[model samples]
Target: MIKALIIDDEPLARDIIKSYLKDNIDLKVLAECSNGFEGVKAINDLKPDLVFLDIQMPKINGFEMLEMIDEPPHIIFSTAFDNFALKAFEANAADYLLKPYSKERFLEALEKATQKINSNAPIATQKIIKDHQESVEILDRIVVRFGNKIHIIGLETIRYIQAQDDYVDIYTHEGKYLKQITMKYLEAHLPTDKFVRTHRSFIVNIEFIDKIEVYDKESYVLHLKEGQKISVSRSGYSRLKEVLSF
Candidate 1:
């Protein structure tokens, strides 16, 4: 079972989250706290595997309490507000439940957290997820139209993306496609450590890159390990190199 804690200033919010977890066989609602101070104590003592945190509270804030613990459990921000999407992701938060959230949304967050915990890959991905979450301007895994209906495409699958007129064309190892969102907005939402701009219109996934080739005298090009080539401008190439540590 996934041990869990709920730390929120509002009693109703905490109770609601606990009630949502009632039918979840995989999660154990270890404890609940009404303030950040008590939360710090409960979390330290229980060392729960997960926490549903609220960003605002009296005394210490969620972010401040987060800094107090070592190896903090996976966190899911639970509150009524939705404006903190970017900051919440930048912190590598597991998930967020807006106020008056449904049982389904809470279940979705629980499943997402469980997947990360059970994956065979090293725990480093969790750290990366957290770090990148803190910086994401837009939330990842948005719903999009595939053909007739909507499908969820995780932003992480995109190996490289370029803007096409008003649309952004996304490329992945599996394939490439178009989306309605502007590249400007995508740049803000993508994790800094995962993706970098290599050209004015191009963003490349660092993990998919094979090598960087210096071009004539003007710029460089990244040959993604996937065998796709993307041009990199002077400043953009430098920024890529710095971000990817190449």
Candidate 2:
């Protein structure tokens, strides 16, 4: 039997999917989750073969939850929004089921998922996540996963960000957390008024800046309020000067 999980914030939506699946003896409903937090826990614990995922959920969105997983199951996205259709396909989702869809559409998506599963196809999602991140005009917060725990860091609390190979280290007053993301994406998404890419490897929050010291004729160093110093390149200094107007 094909084990599946339904993750949606609405109770009615879950009920509808369940109702449609009653006749599909080949598939089994493993669990139902109301929010992304429960969805993450269920997905990790149950390890379902297929997931009916909703894009917008409490705590974290579906895309953010997917990032936390090492190997995500074949996904059939079910959401009210049509704007995410391109992104869902970019992620190579099994199918995109718009809300209020008929049972026939659900079955069609299920058939596609079954074929992929039987063929042992892998889900490639990195590009889609990157695409989704870039589509956002501004970032108010970031989600990071450590073991089984998930942390949501607001932009206001972020002291700085440092690139570490393919991952980036996000530093806040509370602590530092490593996330698998690109600095370029963050540089483009983060609020320009509050954050500045002070160097190729560093992006600093202006509120955290204590002082700026001239390291040389072409470069400088930033002293944050927490006493951590960051190196600034000539181009970075120019950008900083434009933002700080100094």
The most accurate candidate by TM-score is 2
Q: Candidate 2, after superposition: displacement of residue 98 in Å?
A: 0.9
- lDDT string for model 1 (111-200, tens) is 888887777323332453345344545555543434433334576787899889977778765566666666666677777788888887
Tell me which residue pairs clash in candidate 1: 80-99, 89-133, 89-134, 90-133, 90-134, 90-135, 91-133, 91-134, 92-130, 210-225
Instruction: Pull out the clashing pairs in model 2.
Output: none
Q: Each candidate's root-mean-square deviation in Å? A: 15.6, 1.7
Each model's lDDT? 0.72, 0.87
Q: How many backbone clashes does every candidate have?
A: 10, 0
Per-residue lDDT of candidate 2, residues 1-246 (tens digit): 889999999999999999999998999999999988888899899999999988889878998888888777888888798475466465554478888899999888889889888888776455566567766778888999876799889889999999999999999988899999888889988989999999999999999999999999989999999899999999999999999999
Per-candidate TM equals: 0.48, 0.94
| lDDT accuracy of residue 124 in candidate 1 | 37
The most accurate candidate by lDDT is 2
Clashes of 1: 10
